[model samples]
Target: MTTVRPLSCPHCGGKEFSFPDKGRCRCLACRSEFLLDETPKPSPARPSGGAGPRRLAALCFLLLLLAGLLYALAPAPAPQPASQPARQRAATPAVTYELQQLALAADPTRDGAPLVLRVRGGLGQKGPAGYVADCYDPRTQAWSEETQRLQDAVGKNAREIRFQAMSDGSLFLVLDKSRLFSFDFAARQWVDARPLLERQPRLAGGVVQIEIGYANEGDALRVMTADGTRRYFYPAVDLAPTYDELRRMVADYRHPQAERRHGFTFARKGAGTSGPQQLIRYAFLDNKTGPRLFGGYLEWDGEGQARHVKRHAHIFRQAHLEATDFFTPDRVYYRASVAWADKEDLIISFRPTPHPDAPSLLQSLDPEDGAIRWTLQCNFDGELVKTADGFYLLQGAKLFRISEGRRPLAEPQRLF
Candidate 1:
């Protein structure tokens, strides 16, 4: 009945529609029915031109400003520490050693150079099976292997082996009680000592023990038999002496008569002569207790003139001197081993019998005054060796060079 504005479907916003009823219309594009009044109408034009674009720009600037404020207020992620390279660790050194039985051989040909004998084999093995002898020179700090094999001559069931250096630059290897082998340095081989052993009359009896000592002439070997007889044989000569005969000979030549003085009896234990000076070590026993009371030494001139007798009363109380040696009657004995370090000092090694837990000690004493110069804690059973180079202590598989200075006992240098 009047001019009608254009109408579109509300569901699909399409201008194309069909009137299904007077008030309802159906969209041809979406095929949805809707009331004619529910259709959307076009928007009217605004008076403010381009205001929406400026408002959108202002909203974007506000969002950026808010984000900047949040970044400033929040703690800036803690500056990550600059990455660094890792540090490396250091390296350690290596130490090497071997467990074995070692013995010292003093070679006169090498000017008292220490020759160590190292026995390599199983402890339970009979005789010399898998046995080898390795030599160590302490002066040079070097090791040398022996080329000769010792299995055949050294014998089975050998418990101990020892080397005795002779005056003629030769060596004697004593293999327990089984056999003896002489080492010829020139030929570099082991020579069976049977021929020399046959030269002694006492060889008919089984040899029980052997000892080496310095006689007036040269190096002498003392052989003991199971029948409680001892015979001294000179390796350089065919002459041998019986125990009693040798005792008489030694008493007449080297030893002085036992003397009683100051309520003690003094018997010579050792003696040495150097040119015009002579020194004699004596074991002084108490007249009543019969135990050794102290250490005594006699100093005299070559003209048979006697010097003052020096008595070391403190020596009896030292740990090296057994308490039994001082207290027990008729049990007077010296467990300490003594060696002459030089013309002036005597080196003594001993362990205290009373304090069995105490360490063994090496003490140097002035023979003239009996004053202790210094003391070193070491193995009492270690062999105290005197060479032209200096004094050495051979204990087990280790060798220590002893210092002769007056300074307090410093750690000894281990040569091996």
Candidate 2:
């Protein structure tokens, strides 16, 4: 193929044109400057630095996005082991125990006051330097007016070790020890309060008593905080269930049986082989409820299948509960710290405050259905005493025997 060149300048229509440079031309007759052809000239290339930052910025954004996605998809952390340093953890805010009246099932057989069981929480600035509790003597079956602080209840060392009441008339106390003298009224002499297990407590006698000393579930597994409120993972009850039982339960609930291949277990809930609220808690490590610890109560229907399952899932990253309310209600009860439950009365923590005089809210429920029979405002100062015949709620030094019978709580018999 042959290439042909035009011999005219478009600028001035002159045939005589001269090249001023490789890219440009000029007409000699008209003195007009022009390019060799009508093709547009290319502009100078921009510096690489000009666009480098924008590309770099885009790359950075992609890396950041990837990092965020990885973080979101990560598995939830497991329950922290006891050995991990908690330097990064925020302090657990102190919870004020507003228990002005503590139910003392000191002696149900005798009943004036229940049994005299006195418990005191550490008064962090408001009153006391320690936590202490006492029970009526089993020998005399009487509430001792004087309560001596157990060695375990001193300073802040054992402040968080809570006292729990059992369905049995017997009280359960746990501690390494601040010792107590057991007087045998039948023998009229002081006896050794021994043969006591350091952690596992049982209602051995009519009155709640134990040898004084905090028997650490394991070697002082934790450093005692100044306020004695630091929590540690105690030895768990060896209740890991068998795989066959769990499969049966999961099948009963009508969910995918293959789902049981993952981690799961079930445990019975009740006290000393008694109560209408008996249940089996089916716990599984599921992220469906946001991981952490999620499970439910396996309530069986008349057809022997799990019809209603009550769930228990919460972020317990800070502290472990040594004890919880005895009764689990159908709905949420905000900060429901259950104190005690008997044949007639059920005590729930009212609110947190500094005053010792503020009583906890006590509700009497029908033993048959757990419906609220009545509600009474009572203190948990550990002054509610049980005698051979009735119960009494003590505020300060004054004794107000709890009005008995089926009257509404507002009409609680004003027994002196």
What TM-score does prediction 1 earn? 0.47
TM-scores for every candidate against the unseen true structure:
0.47, 0.30
**Winner by TM-score:** 1
Error of 1 at 296 (Å): 15
Q: Which ten residues in a row have the lowest lDDT in candidate 1?
A: 323-332
In candidate 2, which residue ranges exceed 4 Å CA deviation?
1-103, 108-113, 117-167, 171-191, 197-308, 312-361, 370-372, 377-400, 405-416
Q: Write the per-residue lDDT of candidate 2 for residues 8-123, one digit (tens) a residue.
A: 76766677767768978788888978666673444555676758889989999999999999999999999886763676476656645322323334454444224445555545
Per residue, candidate 1 scores C-alpha lDDT tens digits across 36-138 of 7776665754658788999999999999999999999997677887765454233433322222466665566665665666655433334334445556777
Ten-residue segment with the worst summed lDDT in candidate 2?
Answer: 215-224
Compute the lDDT of residue 210 as modeled in candidate 1.
Answer: 71
